[model samples]
Target: MKGKEILSAIKKDIDEHVGEKVLLKANSGRRKVMVREGILEKTYPNIFVIRVEGNDRTSRTISYSYSDILTQTVQLVFKNNNVAI
Candidate 1:
């Protein structure tokens, strides 16, 4: 797939999985990575949101673009089957 096509495909995949539990892995730069468990919240034309709960019981949402997935800067795995979405 071309760049735009790939991004659109990623968006569609996430759209189909909205409201499901997901494990997120994000690269934070300098060889650091952040991992979190969250619910696939919403998807906009340009980005998708995930609702994550902190260890302290506070919940917050994070948003990432489909291009992030295309570039492997972020990854989403379905919690049910341990498969990357």
Candidate 2:
């Protein structure tokens, strides 16, 4: 799929999961892989936010743009099935 189409679909799925729990897997570098379970907080025009809880039980929000998802820097998974956008 074209980049734009893929981005749009990702946005749609994010909208559907707002306020629901999902897994976010991000790879910033070879040794910087991050996997967190969070609630899909919201979807913005150019970005989406997730509310992740830390080991200490503190919650924080992280925002990633569509470009991030499109480039595979961030991946969203629900119920073990990766949301392929």
Candidate 3:
């Protein structure tokens, strides 16, 4: 999927699920998105594993590139799952 599409899908999933978790398999070099002040927390074309805990609490988001991914499965448990990424 394209970059915006991937990000949007992941964001929407997080919003709908509340305190649930989701994973996004994205292209490498995607982690430049979450960079901090002169520091890099992650590197990409990776799978972004995200967990939503509620009320602005720090969610754990890590990305792994496509090449690095061994296996992938996407499950939409609560409907509204047609959104692409």
Cα distance off (Å), candidate 2, residue 18: 0.9
TM-score of 2: 0.82
What is the C-alpha lDDT profile of model 2 across 1-85, one tens digit per residue?
Answer: 6877888887887787778778888987977989999988888988988999999999999999988877789888875455543
lDDT (Cα, tens digit) per residue for candidate 1, span 1-85? 4888888888888888888999999999999999999999999999999999999999999999888898899999998777796
Residue 81 error, candidate 2, Å: 7.3
Instruction: Give lDDT per model, in order.
Output: 0.91, 0.83, 0.36
Model 2 ranges with Cα > 4 A deviation:
80-85
Order of the predicted models by TM-score, top scorer first: 1, 2, 3
| TM-score per candidate | 0.93, 0.82, 0.24
- Candidate 3 residue pairs in clash (backbone atoms < 3 Å): 27-45, 28-44, 28-45, 29-44, 29-45, 45-65, 46-64, 46-65, 47-64
lDDT of 3 by residue, 15-69 (tens): 4553332334333353432211111133233433444333466554443433232
Candidate 1 Cα RMSD (Å): 1.3
Candidate with better lDDT, 1 vs 3: 1
Where does model 1 exceed 4 Å of error?
Answer: none
Q: Report model 1's TM-score to 2 decimal places.
A: 0.93
**Model 2 lDDT, residue 43, Cα:** 89
Q: List the residue pairs that clash in candidate 2.
A: none
Which model scores highest in lDDT? 1
lDDT of 3: 0.36
